[model samples]
Target: MSPASTAAASAGPSARRQASGPAFALTAGVIGLCLAASAVPSPLYRLYAVRWHLPTSTVTLIYATYCLGVLASLLVFGRVSDTWGRRPVVMTGLSGLLVAMGLFGFASGAAWLFAARAVQGLATGIAISASGAALLELRQGRDPATASLANVVASALGVGAGGLLGAVLLQFAPAPLVTPFVVLAVLVAVLLLGMTTVPETVPRVSRSGLRIATPGVPRQIRAPFVVAGLAITCAWSIIGIYLGLAGTLAPALLHTASPLAAGLAILALGGASAVPPLVARALPPAVQIVWGTLALIGGIASMAWSLSADSAVLFVAASVVIGIGVGFAMFGALRTVGAAAPPDGRARVMAAFYIVAYAAISLPAVAAGFVAQRLGAEATFQIFGAGIVAVSVGTLLPALARHRAQHRAQHRA
Candidate 1:
């Protein structure tokens, strides 16, 4: 952290109205809720396809629509919290999410699902961006990285837990399509209410009303911001491909056709991803980024070899390693980026970060879909893994150089 940001963060708590400890915890929970809500809809997509008699192509388009919504939302409203205060924007986003849940619960056709997804994506984008910035502001003590660590770990855990929960409900619910969303609606509604108790983190001086600001990395933060963008791209692209193929891999490469087994793989991925951030909490963000990139490069190689050898054990092992790498890489990247951002514009910077992240999630998965169609799932995994390995190497060199430079400086000091 720069001297300025470190001083500001350290000084923030005493200057602002003190928030309840539980309210700060709830702020973190809101991030988990938004991510979990995003994951829940995936299990129901197949049901949507079956009941609506939609083709796989159309189903993909529907999923893509949600991605578009998230990107657009981040672009437009990413800085609203910066201008209007964090709590109100969070409240507005959660309320929108509640409406999205209602749409899913009551949908009669694919059109309703599309609308529901669009709203859900948009709401999630705004809520999480603001809450992320709020977390930095609400952070206790002296360390500013805790919020970034929480953001990474919560997001990973949320995806896994949500996917499993959705799968279970899909398997057992009397009305599978409606039930999962209804449960989501209940959670969102509760979160919406809970927000009322949280202190607004945006300072009075920062309020300027809502403006439609594009997500941007301000000039002041370009160096770390560029590194963050690269790190996030590598980390999340690996995750995107894994999620896109993991279920298919269960049937094609892992020699398992059962849905439960596929869901377990995703759960394991999330669980593994959550662990490293906690352990690496004391490490500098730059070190974490380089180490995480190294893990990705190795994971990609192993998975490619597994595909060639048709070894399920090797594939599972690769997934676990990559997951840990993701936790460290992303937590570090986010911490670096967030720490560098000027406080008044923190929401917009976070918005920019998430935009890169969501794009990584959507674009790579789409390409993986194309690869799966043309070359078969196994070939898709191999080709994509090799491709990511190459890119990760490119990402790794710069990070390693930067880490070494930092180490040398610390030693000289």
Candidate 2:
């Protein structure tokens, strides 16, 4: 039997007994909530910068700090859920999330913001791994494709909602920073209650202790893994640029002082991101990657031109295009990797994938902040946009070549 079959067989009677009802939707909702909470701070980052008189470099470091915490969690506890039951691990993550939300809501200074974000990252990292695995196992008919699509949609919605909600609260609510987090805290509490009804998909197994190791891709799938990693990394790099810098950048580049404007820009990027997965659900993964990469390249280039020309119309258009490109490319990469992994190793494989992807998301944004401090935001956008274009083009080549080879082989047969 294949490894996936072997893993399913290992689930035994306990797994079958627990596999009834609407667990898929519940798990997916939990995933969405976790991601939304993570994004709640996007609009607030610029406000924090203004309130604390923080430099761009300091702001980026604060953002990257969260990613560091996530990396640490994934490296240490990524596979812990595999040994323990998924529910316990998920609940633990949610508890951590609550603490993070409380910290953000009550934050008084830079230290509080940094600490809150780190805790948020740790909580999100843990929750994402366990929830993603649970979704796969709890999915109706064990459809990996549908599960992957749900994951992508949930992520996009979470990001968009978080940014828009933060914007609205900041504009009208009494306490901008505090109110958004308080709202998220309440939402998370509700999600925690809802999680109680979801079934545990991973059977509890006796293990000696926690196993801490680096997440690794199996040797057989290394080629596709590299392609997927590159695709996701490139796509996330674009997203990181927006998340880390858009709020700050939008005001300066577009000459707008409104927080709502900044928030809407992010919301547009995120909302547009959700479109591709629904539109291209039936396309082959390779086709999706190629088209997505092309869109990424074009979108970045358009943004660069828009910045130079000071065209809000072009900038908005670019954001939408970039969003669609990222959504398609990332979803395709995730589906490819998830489908290739054995059921038992899916979480570890996903953890490994995200470690690389998040690194791409965090590190470059921090670097760009330092560069923007000295060179100016306009120059920085040009430089980062060019780099993204190059990377996307480079990533597209191998995927297209492989697709062509597969087509040729099929034709010959």
Candidate 3:
């Protein structure tokens, strides 16, 4: 075997030896909390818009900033934990999150929101990479599938919880914006304590220093990789619209100022996202991609109709459909990429996937925001919806074609 293969093979046993069930659970919890914290501001963005007299463009820019931070961290430090060990990187990420929460709690204007979200994005980017790696390593004789599921479930729950918590706090608490961050700070502190008890999975390796590396896929797996990458990008871009604009759109469409209602819209999206993975885990990847894309296109079209007609109920239903679609598509894409990746190069493959996905998440929202500035929310939603449908159809065609060809060849054989 090559030296690189030998190193990875040896490292696997040691990583497994360090696995502990409790530690694995703690790591997963931390990942969930990080994601939840990231979403905490989703429901509150409209409130900021009102309080600060910010425009829709500014609000979208603030949301997009977080994605930029995530992209930067993924590109630069996504694999750093592999060299330096997971514990230190995760702990540092947790610390960054705490600081972000504090910043959010004290923010007096848009500048604070921008800085806090950037920090939160960076922290989450780091924590997720480290924690995900830790979960796979600490699978304790279970298939790595469990780790993947846990990660997705935790992320969806976190997003849902954050939006709901923000809404509740906005409704009940004296200080709407401040209380959510304060509560998040407390939760993160507890997580940090739990993290301290978790053992390191990656042994420290000598390196000159941090270097920027582009993640690469092997030539043999390039076809599936592109398919998965496009699916993930499209899925996340749809999610970006939901996260960045749903709160703003819901209140406008409903013609009400109810924070609770707005929060519920986001919660529906997040909750529905978690459902499909549990329900459709057994489906083949190609089937998952096709059905998921169909659901997404339907949801996006419904949302556009709801916006144009000013039907709040339709909007909420569409959010649920979008969530379900995102869940299935994301899970299937990850599974496809994971299955095709070389054992030793999985991290790099995932890193590249995230880079593409996050770029999709950020760039489209920024463009939509600019468009919203000119055409208004209704027109922007229609355009965005149409665009997503096009991409979904574009991705689905080749995937279905390949699946049909494979089945036909097998039948002939």
Question: For candidate 2, lDDT tens digit of each residue in 335-370?
Answer: 777667666676688788878887888888878878
lDDT of 3 at 397: 85
lDDT of candidate model 3 versus the reference: 0.78
So what's the TM-score on candidate 3?
0.89
For candidate 3, write residues 1-413 as lDDT tens digits: 12334334524554555454677778888878987887788778878888999887777778777888887877787877665667777888899999999999999999998999899889877777768666665653445556666767777778788888888899899898899999999999998988887876554443324444656678988988888887887788887767767666877877877888677887898899888778877777777888889889999999988887889889989999998888878877776776665544545666777788778777887888888778876787788878889999999987787568767998999
TM-score of each: 0.93, 0.92, 0.89
Select the stronger candidate by TM-score from 2 and 3. Answer: 2
1 or 3, greater by TM-score? 1
User: For residues 290-399, could you state the per-residue lDDT of candidate 1 as single tens digits?
Assistant: 88889888877888888788888887888788888888889888888877887667888999999998998888777777667778777887877777777777877777
The superposed Cα distance between candidate 3 and the true structure at residue 400, in angstroms, equals 2.3
> Which pairs in model 1 have colliding backbones?
none
lDDT of 1: 0.80
Model 3: CA > 4 A from native: 1-20, 203-212, 401-413
Residue 398 alpha-carbon offset, candidate 2, angstroms: 1.8
Per-model lDDT: 0.80, 0.79, 0.78
User: Ranking under TM-score, best-scoring first?
Assistant: 1, 2, 3
Q: Please give the lDDT score at residue 387 for candidate 2.
A: 89
